[model samples]
Target chain A: MDNYIEIIGFIAAVLTTAAFLPQVYKTWKTKDVSALSLPMLLMFFIGVLGWLIYGVLIDSPSMIFANAITLVSSFLLVYYKIKYQK
Target chain B: MDNYIEIIGFIAAVLTTAAFLPQVYKTWKTKDVSALSLPMLLMFFIGVLGWLIYGVLIDSPSMIFANAITLVSSFLLVYYKIKYQK
Candidate 1:
């Protein structure tokens, strides 16, 4: 069913979006960024922003929602990486 | 244009997926995963896998492609984290 497929997409969106929380929490708590690549975080933030724009273009609410959350989370990681870099 | 929108999605996919390369390379060269969180890696892997499946269901090539590359990259991160952890 179409609804079922949409549900799957929603679940996938949630999974991928929520997956970043642990990293954000860990980084916030420990501020250990030695292994966290700054370039990677920057690129991911830009990329997810792109996804958000694309989602808006496509008018997919799930994609928009997922990418928005991911954008914020990746941005936090980037901020922490820069702030905590030794 | 629809084509342009699709192009944006492709670009976003490429950036998000390719973003992992730097981290992978750094980890490979340094084998320093102290900042890498195992829970994050595991959750991201599962999430990306879910995205891959949803992409298939949605018949989105870009989603499938992006998630596939990300899945492998994240898996490698997990592998390195476990293998190199001190």
Candidate 2:
């Protein structure tokens, strides 16, 4: 059961992390941040930080791995929001 | 400690869940989703489903609680993406 749960966690991690790919690509291509919410980006960055801490606590590599990528992506999103805010 | 870990999870949950507020608000006001990615939303929904399953398996109320809100929000995001694709 635990193994299955971990497998689910890994798959979840991949899906969630991969989901950001298209967003990043679109943003990179369009360079539009108007529809993107600045506060939401910041909030998500902090949220992912909390998740990272929780992952560290639980010693779950999948959680840590997923949140790490998310954190980086959130940071880039925030950076994009700030840098390209019109 | 498990208690502390749970606290972190809760905080993460709140942060991640609440991050959607501004997006929801802006989308409701403008009804624009050009910046939103449909494929991303679908991937997120699946990811959250996995998370929800993992949450149930682990019996982590915080995980379950957080992912449930995210799942609903992602669905709405998807709905918005499909409904308002101009």
Candidate 3:
């Protein structure tokens, strides 16, 4: 059961974290952030940072790994939001 | 220290989960899913589902709550992608 749960966590992390890839790809390919929301990106960045801290404190590698990727993905979006948004 | 970690997790949950709102709003408002990738959305949906199971198994409220909201938001995106994509 514990192993099952861990597997679930791993799957969840992979899916959720990877979800941002499309946006990242689109943002990268188009270099367009006009439609992306700055406030939303900012909130996500802050939130992912919090998750990273939380993962570190809990010593959960699954959480850490997932949030770490999420952080980068979201950060890129935020960066682009600033760089490309009109 | 533990409390602090929990707090961090809570904040992380709030931020990450809330991060999807803008997209949801945009999708709803614009009724456009052209830029959104179906593959990515599908992966994210699967991943969040796994996280939900993990949360249930671990008996963690923070994880459960965050993933639950994420599930809804992502699901909406997926629904819209199917509905509005060109």
Each prediction's number of clashing residue pairs? 0, 0, 0
Q: Quantify all predictions' global Cα lDDT against the true fold.
A: 0.84, 0.86, 0.82
Off by over 4 Å in 3: none
- By how many angstroms RMSD does model 3 differ from the true structure? 1.9
Clashes of 1: 0
Q: Which consecutive 10 residues in model 3 chain A have the weakest lDDT in total? A: A1-10
**What TM-score quantifies how close candidate 1 is to the native fold?**
0.82
Q: Looking at every candidate separately, what fraction of the true A–B Cα contacts under 8 Å does it contain?
A: 0.75, 0.94, 1.00
TM-score of chain A of 2: 0.92
Candidate 2 residue A85 Cα shift, in angstroms, is: 2.7
Better of 1 and 2 by DockQ: 2
* Alpha-carbon deviation at B30 in model 1, angstroms: 3.5
Q: Lowest summed lDDT over 10 consecutive residues: which window, candidate 2 chain B? A: B20-29
- Per-residue error (Å), model 3, residue B82: 2.3
Q: DockQ score of candidate 3?
A: 0.79
Candidate 1, residue B26: how far the Cα is off, in Å: 2.8
